[model samples]
Target: MRAPKSHVRVALATTLLAGAALTGSAAAAGFAHADSSRAGDANIAPVGRADLHPEASPLFSVARRLPKVSADQVLRLAESQVGVRENGYGGGTKFHDWYMNSPRARETVARDGGKVTDYRNAAWCDMFVSWVGDKLGIRPAMGWDAYTVSHASWFKENKRWGTHPVRGAVVFFGWDGGKLLHNIDHVGFVIKDNGDGTIQTVEGNTGNGKVEIRTRPTADVVGYGYPVYTA
Candidate 1:
């Protein structure tokens, strides 16, 4: 059979609690112990919290230091990074390989150290975002799973992604492409909004190629979440 939605919610909640504890960051999104039973029960209303920093210019400064990367820049990064590999799903693609193995993105994170980029792992997008969170000085950003769980809770409760992209918006992708049962495997930052329903992002493990920017269709986006990276 399949795990009931309630079980999934409980598992997700447990993951969030453990993740938050590991990162030593307090739950400020007002989602602490969110009752998943209430999820999607109604059209969500706008909810805000002090933990999530508001969008601002300084948030984009770190990305600007790079080569003026835009949506296209991110797309090129993804295009160059896409990899054909054998995975649990048989011949599959691995998008996060670059964060661990790529010399360019790794070098950027190593040199910057919580300033330019944070590279938690050379090959995982979650780690890449964790490093980015550190560069931006957000403590909870370190826990890859927590970041995801928190965002999931936020979405389950709020019903809409935040207004604008910040440094650490939880970028979610379908594990098997819209198969919610697979859980989310990819996450990253919004490098730029093309303003035409496309977004450029810098993510790790985009593939064996390298840590780079890539573009994906936002029309089918399942989730867009943000984390408190700064005060």
Candidate 2:
């Protein structure tokens, strides 16, 4: 079944709250309850903690590096991506759908009886990175995927993004309480952090695929993940 935009936001928020030592869904229920002051505060006042898990990799060190890119930049980058045609359920209503059809992405989805249709899941993140990297002439991936993977593990292992949920920080989720179950299947970016445990998140596949910005519950956050983008 196709995921609902509201549900996706809920899922993403739920995971982050759960990470903040918030208990139960009620602690940070709904997109309206997400707060980012703690995250924002961390950005203003960076702190350090011992790596609880020796084997686990650290959270991306460059989450605060460079000014956070604007939503327009992200959109422009997304729109310029080259999409590869295939077949599947077009997930959302994003305009970026016009350019995210990566050849390899299309080929992979076609094998699953699906086509590359939406930016949220069509390897669009990679495509977005590709476009932005080539245009800005910087390294791609921005450590988005790797940081997400590690952050999911960090919440499971060390239980921290080790930083604040700033713009460009990757938000991740899983089945209720399962952190490692994260597959980059769902992703969003922090846009605004209201102090009252609520946040505004600009996410893909949200609000029927229009890249809508919505409020999220922060107290139930399971993890605050980030990508490494060292200068």
Candidate 3:
């Protein structure tokens, strides 16, 4: 016998409601399963904090309020380290320690046939620039070598080498007028163009192993390596 039209409608509606309930329950269970899979993972945040509730977290608020790093900020960071001095001859200064603590420090030391512990007192002008780059998140790609020649060559091969000065560019120096990627002796971060064929720079391991802000004639600069910074 054919059921009443109203009864058929009610039956269909009941089936749809039951199906929806089952689907919702399955979805919730799946979410729970996924959450459990990450239960002991140290990188996973706690349950209440797992979601992206930036407004609810103080850390996120502080991060949001922090200023964006630009070329000017990078120059400032280099300037702030200007007064750092080496402790002795072999290794011990904060600047050297900073470089040694960098993620690639071990590789750099090994490549240079240097002891990791002795890197603190090495001719670290290049390492200082590298550390600054690492802090600014512009390194490795910007060339993180502790050797000036290696760093300059990396820049040249990457097409970042130039003679023109840009603020925050890495300046390579060769005391004997050696070429840019060869015989490079020291490196520093350029602060500004003096407009008189010179540039002001903050350099490490200068004038008795102290970081100093100094003026260098453009003629002494073999080349400038520009970092890929947005600002």
Candidate 4:
């Protein structure tokens, strides 16, 4: 028997509404699942730190604090190379190899007009500074110019140039009476302030072609190039 048309219409409308409700609930469940997955991902830690108990991790101990690569580390690294010596006039193969292999060495060579082999038999005071900066991961801020004049200019341009002595600062020298940016002849890392108007520095390519720690009066220092190191 055929039902009334109004009755059939009401039944059809009811079915459509029921289907829409079910579709909305499913969409909400999918959204909730996605949110839960994101929350789980957020709880995950770095690989090495995640496996260890919180107290067992090396980062847990204050006594076992790792030294960050900063100014202090740079000074220490430079000091460690104190006994390194050149074989002859402009002959420090170790220093040369370090400079040659550096990421910025080619740029330095191009700017300064020197070959990789020439560095082995070249003035390497600047090269030593470049090597230290590269090793410490501060090359972008410290610069790796093969010439002191060029390095000094970079410092001045970047506003890292200074005068007062600070540990780990690179000290540029100018023996000639002219502008420091133009006359810079050598560079080194400052070790101490000396507290008496002088600074003790660890310099490469000094005194018989050997790395040496020397004391220099502040008056003789042209200026200092400060690296952007972590405080």
lDDT of 3 at 134: 65
Between prediction 1 and prediction 4, which has the larger TM-score?
Answer: 4
Whole-model Cα lDDT per candidate?
Answer: 0.39, 0.37, 0.59, 0.59
- Candidate 2 has a TM-score of 0.43
User: lDDT tens digits, residues 1-231, model 4?
Assistant: 011121111111111101122223534433212232223232222222232232221111211122234677888889999989987776744877786675445544444454555555667888888788767655654666556666666555544567667778889887663544655667898898898988899999888888999998777788887655533
Judging by TM-score, tell me the better candidate of 1 and 3.
Answer: 3
Error at 224, model 3, angstroms: 0.7
Clashes of 1: 17
A best-first ranking of the candidates according to their lDDT comes to: 4, 3, 1, 2
Residue-level lDDT for 44 in candidate 3:
21
* RMSD to native, candidate 4: 26.0
Please rank every candidate by TM-score, starting with the best. Answer: 4, 3, 1, 2
List where candidate 2 sits over 4 angstroms from the true fold. 1-163, 174-177, 183-185, 228-231
Maximum-lDDT candidate: 4
Residue 213, model 2: lDDT of 59
Q: If both were scored by lDDT, which would come out higher, candidate 2 or candidate 4?
A: 4
Q: Of the candidates numbered 1 and 2, which has the greater lDDT value?
A: 1
**Candidate 3 global lDDT:** 0.59
Clashes of each: 17, 34, 1, 1
* TM-score result, candidate 1: 0.44
lDDT score of residue 35 within candidate 2: 36
Q: Candidate 3: deviation at residue 160, Å?
A: 0.6
